[model samples]
Target: MVSCYSSHGMVRQSWDLFSSMRRSGFPGDGFTFSALLGARASSSCSDHAKLLLLLGISVHGLVIRLGLHLDVVVATALLDMYAKCGRVAEASRVFDAMVLRNTISWNAIIVCYGQHGGGKEAFELFVCMMRDGCCPDELTLSSLLSSCADMAAANEATQLHAYIVKIGFQDFLQVGNALIMAYGRNGFVQEATQMFGMIPNPDLVTWSSMVSSFAYLGLAKSAVHLFDRMLQQGIQPDGVAFLGVLSACSHAGLIEDGFKYILLMMRDYKMDPTPQHLSCLVDLLGRSGRIKDAYDFVVNMPFEADVDVIGAFLGACRMRGNIESAKWAASKLFSLKPNDPVNYLLISNTYAAAGAWSELAKVRSVMRNMCGNKVPGCSWIEIGGIVQTFVSNDMILHQSREMQKMMDLVSLVERYCNDDDIICNDPSLV
Candidate 1:
């Protein structure tokens, strides 16, 4: 009853029933206690989790005080509670104090670590489990593989792949899909493709993974072809599948193809275009300089065009130097997200480029009056097994000093033509 109520978000009712049960002095067993903990954890009430912890601790204290047995099930529930409550440290403490540990205990802790971005710790624990002669089952490998993939540990992922093959789990669809995701995420598109092909009976997830792999690698044409083949093979495309198709079409500048798929999605499949699909379409059309069509589409959209959709159109207008459309898009974007600095910057840049000095001044003045906050630009690079992120105009290691030197060199370049007309007509002539 507690689990059902919690699952349905009826926290008050769950607690009321629990309170009544406690008042009746009915002794709660392990399952009842676990359910109570789950209800408390999933409740929307603030501090419900903390109250649950207190109740659990009290129960545990009573159990120890009364010399009751410390069973693995109770310990696992306790660990799960602590982990879910964002107290992984407490969870680890409980695990350490366990008199008997099982694979479930290990899996819970590993999942907690993965959720908290402690992938390295999870992987290390897996190693320790193996060193202690504990055999990992499919669940264990699945958890480890997910962590490795999220952390982009390609070498570790490859080793796990080898282990899966050795253990005859290579044919397992779930495992193969995970391997595909890992390889694609780590930029090993070729390896991911091979793994996808090796899955003899590919499910929807398998097909989506292959299509997404191409999308991620920017092989948009190949992705489109794969989606076509999937349809030809009678594989029904899900939302994720369409997302890949639309994303591929967007990146490859296949505006016509994207528009076709959007219509096909509604006509043949009766699937409504999600906000993501709409945003992609707007981006596609706007970037292709079909500003009027993009604007009309957004204006006539059945659902509200979210800030993301408007931003997409705005960015596309900026990229194409369509100052008129950019101003219009900016108005919609600013109305939707007034405090978004990127929109303000984009509008200001557009106005300045169009020689609307007064408009540019007004835009910049508005930005200045709106708390003086500006959006910062950032870039990331991965090298030698490490990823480095840097913000614009911020000193980023060796690059900061080198940047000034490059700017100085650019300033000193010889000018072949000083005439504005010639420079505008043919910059390469210089």
Candidate 2:
């Protein structure tokens, strides 16, 4: 009953069942804790997630009291639950508390950091995983490569690629696909294409990754060509494949091609368009400067327009300074993401673009009151073989430390350029 209720997200029922089990004198074990912890992680959004997080904390207390915290399986489940709850620090604590960990344990922690843009943390954990002699699986490499892509750490990606080749994990399709994407995202599309060529019996993901690489480079013709080649080989295109092609078309202003693939995905492949597909369509329509058509398409879609679609519409409106369309899109965006400062900023930016200073000021005032804490943007620098990454919040969190780092950077520059002979009076310096 606990598993059933938890799996279906019946939070109250799951807890009631657990209470009944305890009353029935059936001792809780790792499986019981795992199931209950999973229920916490299953929470979707809004107040319910908060409620689950509180309940999950209670469960953690119970686990500690019962001495089940030392159980490797239970500890792993707890760590995973904390990670899923967006409590990275707590998750790290749980991981550090564990005496024995397996591959899945390392993976859970690595993935938690990776998903939250903690690329430096994830990489450090990967190094620890290797130092501890726990062999990494394909998913591990894939997750790390994904972090590399997100960070645009070209040097890191190249080094990871070399390590994969050394460990003979290059043949793993997941790793291969991730490497292609990482290389492409880092502006090494030719290397990505070469990697694609080297893959023996490439699967659907390999082909899709290659297509996306081309699409990202605005090589729409090449993307479409490779997509067609995949079809010719009798591999049915999935939603991702269709999304890649649609994105390619959108990037290149090939609205006809975009519509063609979207229709083909739904009609020929009998697959429903995902949110990403719709967002790409919005982009395609917006790129063509058909604002009304795009707005109408979004309104008339089977599902309501999500943040991405509305945001895309707003972006197009900004380009044209279409205040009315921007307002309309902003209204929908605000409803979809009420507390997201990005939405407020987007609308405010659109208003500024339209020279609606009064409206922009109004939005900014509202943002200051309702959303004081926005997601922090991150930046990084490589110095002396060390990658120092920081986020916007760090200024307030560690202003002195950050200032010191900046001063050190200035000092390093002075060491190289303080004399002014190398850079002074050089004609190219101008």
Give the TM-score of each candidate: 0.71, 0.80
lDDT of 1 at 80: 79
**Can you write out model 1's per-residue Cα lDDT over 315-405, one digit (the tens) per residue?**
7777777887888888887888787788798888777767788988999889888738675776755555454567867785787788788
Q: Residue 371, candidate 1: how far off, in angstroms?
A: 7.9
Cα lDDT over the full model 1: 0.79
Extract clashing residue pairs from model 2: none
Candidate 2 minimal-lDDT segment of 10 residues = 391-400
- Per-model C-alpha lDDT, please? 0.79, 0.87
Best candidate per TM-score, number?
Answer: 2
